[model samples]
Target: MKETYEEKINRRLKVKQRIIEVAAGREKADLVIKNATYLNVFSNEFLQGDIAVANGLIAGIGEYEGEKEIDVNGKIVLPGFIDAHIHLESAMVTPSEFAKAVISHGTTTVITDPHEIANVMGLNGIDYMIESTQNLPVDVYFMLPSCVPATAFDESGAGLGYKDIDSYFEHKKVLGLAEMMNYVGVINGDGDVVSKIIASQAHHKKIDGHAPELSGNDLNAYIAAGVYSDHECSTFENALEKLRKGQFIMIREGTAAHNLSALMPLLTKQYSDRCMFATDDKHPSDLLNGGHIDYIVKQALKNGADPIVTLKAATHNAARYFLLNNKGAIAPGYLADIVVADNFADFNVEMVFKRGKLIFDGEVKEFDAPSVDETLVEKCHNTFNLDEVTPNSFKVDGKLGLIGLVGGELLTRNLGFADKTDVENDILKIACVERHKNTNHIGVGYVKGYSLKSGAVATSVAHDSHNIITIGCSDTDIAVAVNAIRKAKGGIAVVENGEVKALLELPVAGLMSEEKLETVNEKLEKAKAEAYRLGADKSIDPFMTLSFLSLPVIPSLRITTKGVFDVEKCELLKDEMSV
Candidate 1:
């Protein structure tokens, strides 16, 4: 039996009446925290009061009696942190596992983009992510993937047009369209891209942006197309320019892209209101070692940032940006998402409460896993369309353009041309095999700065398009690594001397694992050790760095299933380079 709409309204009205009664001191609150110093986001100051909760909502924040009370005499209470943008799949774990890892770190909400898995299974992938995150302690909202294949040059398993995802804007958990990586298309008024933007605008939803290093009329045109926020600003000048153009800047500090230090100057009172913190893509090791939004907040505090301003950026700014009005504050009629910490200096989170429920003290509260459709699970497990590859599949006989890696950045450089693999000078062979349709389309090229002297590394977690990207010194090791990923259905593999040295199987859409965070981090650590042992640069994260090489939307040079791509010109390089 289902409650009628009128009955539902009446029930909510009764709850609201109770909240009013509790706030007016006529009725007892369900729970209350006494002796608290909570952040007043509206005024930007630390105020002392008792926070009362009833019916999973903040009843009041003053002296109040309750059924249960917890005393925190000297602790600071805050609105639980909200991650402005992230990709849960990048952690290489299921949504449930991801929630478990972040809850203890005091992240009560996360706005994610399923573009990574969307490229693999399309609508089904998006559905899978939504279904899996239901009923979790952490509120996991979404921005519907705007660029499924990212661009026309890439071969993703599925392509999502405007029509394909227009209806998703109506979903309760979906905030709006995700990062519009195809800024070129939007500026040029590509019909499909424009249609998506118009649909999101029609629904009055926020459209996230991803135009890195764009400036002048191009940036204005992109903003004119209704893109509201960007997470790809690498320089402070770039972020400031975008900020002046009426765009919110999502300062990204992730496992790979470290843009926080460069943009930390924006954390001042002048710009903090329009700025938010986002990890964009965090790996398992980083999550376990550092934390989530708490990590970002702590970093800002250590760098002499104003504590209240930084805290507001972590909660209020993001909540306001995404239009979650009830969140990011500890006011009456707001959700009772709260965090208790020792102090601002150490920033040690002691307990976390989501919707008035104390879900984390030292250990995370256990809950049932969100039930996903078994059929969808099966489909995700069978994502790899290619069966196998041989040494001959990786041979590229021509003058090759090399992708030079910039340390600690997603930006790559075009290092002119190379006639062959220069292993002595730290150049290695790289390839992106089409694993979606098995067209046997393998784009072979060379990369400098990885400095792998022996074995090969391969993964199914290539960005934008989840293709099987492998790099090695020899053709045999590269083939063996690719075949290992294919045989495992989808995973990352390390090979040397025609044998697998280490592997981390991502059975879920070949992008994430269903395992817990600790297990995935352990396996990833093993694989990383092997990569470093084989002479991978110790300065950067090897696997995470390799995964971004095939992303064509970033800049300078990239590779796809077609061949070496010149992103600025938007064409595949052929005979333009000679030895």
Candidate 2:
């Protein structure tokens, strides 16, 4: 006879409890940790103590007696870091693989926005994320994608309406609605936007906001519309306004944007309660080097913010805002998800515990995560059409507006009229190729200031839409870059002087890889190195900047496969210089 899901869970819990009781009698705990200095995010205090775990929850924490007591005499114990906002797909690996790398860095929980996969595979993709993370030691909660394509102007792999969101909300793993990328809809009072928020609220879920350019009247309107948290504050004034308006300002540090330093100034001991830290979209390379939320905490401290305040933002604030009662604090009854680090500044995670079990002791241990099957791999086969093929397909006439990428910020500086009539040394080209729907809609336009020297860079990792964005000096390289991407299924590729310089294959939905996390990290590092070899010396991972170039939701200049867009006016134009 088959057992119900509830019954299975109950049985497991009962077994876990039984094991704990038996272990206690023997004066032996499943895991006995001693001499650990703990960071109390709740009280903002540090205490030298011992934690005892029997089953998967904190059986007891204080001075404890256990079967195996490993002395961590010189380590500072912290509540496992919680990433308030992240797209797991952006890591270029599956949840299990992503977990392995972060666990060592002391991140035990992730509040993922699977909007990337939602755009490509919809509910099925979400289901894949849910199922994959079920047995993993790390705790991963999800927010239902608020905006499918993120904007009405751009196209995506799929769409989820109110009913779709309502149905998904029934899943126990679903935490709240993901960032509502439709700021215009909220401020403008679009019926669809209102309805989605209402649906989430009806289910007692929190609404996440994504107000990129919103300020003054428009920003006020968004808050009134029920967005509780926002991570896109580009300036101190904007962050302050959002915080004052009762929204948790998630100071984001990610592959594309690093705003922790700028936002760190706002984190006073008093106001630190309303701030949280998140990796909005961390690529494999960044995750391996800097870490998940660990990077944010380190940067915050380096900027002269209080260590405990930064810790509170990373753990307690994020957990309390998301209403995750079971984890985030080192309190009785909370899940035994804790990290042992020597210092808060360095954040060297010596040992990590998720649900009381030692998942990572500076490395992966007995991590039996499931393998990615056909569905996860099959989801990558989005329609790709090349029927509108022309040798010089991305050629554009006259001057165009250039969407200038500001390193380490979500905000783009909109440069208007960058070129006039495609001057010899001032010509910039932006091309968007439809990667999902095989549409021959390859929108091309001239852009200025995004200086490219005779080569093309192509990526299917375009944000929200996951389309192919090709920018180059030569039309031949642009075409080669786009065609090369199609042949590899889905990935980011750079072609210069008729040779492929770099590529990162995202086999899963053409946005993430199904490979191991370490493998992905290695490839990502190689890709970045190669990009540098090909003259991309602007940012740490310029591929992330490349991905955002096609996101039309953000202000200033942007391009979709349809055409160049004035994000402020939300209109497509023939050229950026004309703007």
Candidate 3:
């Protein structure tokens, strides 16, 4: 049975009455923390008070009595952290499992783009994510994927134009349009892309950005189209230029791209307000070992940044950016999402409160599991549609255009042309196998800096399209690795001597695992170790680096199911390569 509109109003009125009374100090609060030093984000100062909570909201932040009370005499209480931008699929675990991992580390709210899964399962994938993350300790919000296939050169499982996603703006948790990766579409006035931007603006929603090295009139045209933020800033000069142009910069520090160190100069009183924190993509090991938003905050503080300013960047700045009015503060009428830590130096979390209820006290407490739609689950569980691949599936005919890896960066260099796989020079064969519709259209090419001496590494976690991508010394090993991933439904596989060495299965839409974070991390560690032993690059995460090879939006050159693509020209290589 559902409550009528009138009944719903009455219920809300009753709750509001109690909140007003508690805030006025005429009635007892549901919970209170006494004698605590907390940051006042509004004033940018430290204050002491007895914080009161009632009906899952901060009733008051001054002297007040409560039915239940706890004292934190020396700890610093701050508003919970918010990740401005992230792809939940990058964690390689289910939403519930990802929530548990971050909540304990002080992340209470996250704005995620489901583009990874959306590229593989379409709208059904977005539906699956929303349904499966409900009623959790951490408040998960959605930024509907703005670029499903990302660009024209790639083939994704589905394509979402403005018409496909306009209705989602009305969803309670949906924030705005996600990263507009196709800056070309926006600048050149592509009808479908412009319509999506227009729709987001029509609803007065924030549109995220993904423009790298875009400047001058080209960048102005992009901003004029109404995109609000960007997380791809890898240099201080680039970030400052965008910030000057009125775009909020998200200082991204994730598994593959570490921009925080370079952009630390932005964490000042002059520029900190227009910035926020984001981990665009983080693997399981990085999440469990380093931390989440908490890691970024700690690193900032250690590097001599003002503690209050850093906290504001992690909390209030993001909340205000996404227009989450009731969050990112500790005051009357605000959501009671808070974190208590011993001090700023260590930033060790001692307790966490979500909506006025204690959820983590050194260890995470048990909570109700999220309810997922079984229909969507059934559809997402079986996304692989390719047939068995053979050695012939990976054979390239002539001279190749190689994708050269840039260590610790997502940018790649186009390493001109090569006649053959130069084993001594660390150049090897790379292939992208179309698995979505079983087209059996394999795009074969060569890569320069993978450094894999013998065995091949393969994954179904290819960017945007989630195809089967593998790199190896010989056609036999690449074929073996690709078939192993197909055999596991979808996963990462390593092959040496025509034998599968290690595997980590990601069966959910070939994007994430339903396993616990610990389980996933353990398996990933073993797989990474095997990859390194077989001579993969030690400076970068081999699997994560390989996943980006097919993303045509990045720069210079890329590979797709079609063939080697020149990103600058936006065309498949013809006379440039001996295909």
Q: Cα lDDT of model 2 overall? A: 0.77
Error of 3 at 446 (Å): 1.3
Give candidate 2's root-mean-square deviation (CA, Å). Answer: 2.8
Which scores better on TM-score, 1 or 3?
1
lDDT of 1 at 372: 92
- List the candidate 1 regions with Cα displacement exceeding 4 Å: 577-579
Looking at candidate 3, what is the lDDT of residue 191?
92
Encode model 1's per-residue lDDT on 384-433: one tens digit a residue: 88857888888777777789999999999998777688889998998999
Give the better candidate number (1 or 2) by lDDT.
Answer: 1
Q: Where in model 3 is the C-alpha error above 4 Å?
A: 575-579
Residues forming the 10-long window of minimal summed lDDT in candidate 1: 570-579
Candidate ranking (lDDT, best to worst): 1, 3, 2
Counting clashing residue pairs in each candidate, in order, gives 0, 10, 0
Q: What lDDT tens digits, residue by residue, belong to model 3 across residues 69-89?
A: 999999999999999999999
**1 versus 3: better lDDT goes to:** 1
Q: What is the TM-score of each candidate against the true structure?
A: 0.99, 0.93, 0.98
Question: Compared with the true structure, what per-residue lDDT tens digits does model 2 show for residues 1-579?
Answer: 899999999999886776566444545566667877777776778877777776666666666777667898887888889999999888888788888878888888888988988887788878778877887777888999988877888888888888877988878888889999888888899998789999999999989988874788888889998899899987778898888888889988888877777787778976788988888888887778777787777777777888888888888888899888877787656778888887755667778878877778757787787655567556545434444344467665666566666656655676655543242554567778876666677776655544455576778888888888877767777788887878777888877787888777776678777788778777777766666665564553557877888887887778887877878887786553443
Model 1 Cα RMSD, 1 decimal: 1.0
How far residue 87's Cα lies from its native spot in candidate 3, in Å, is 0.6
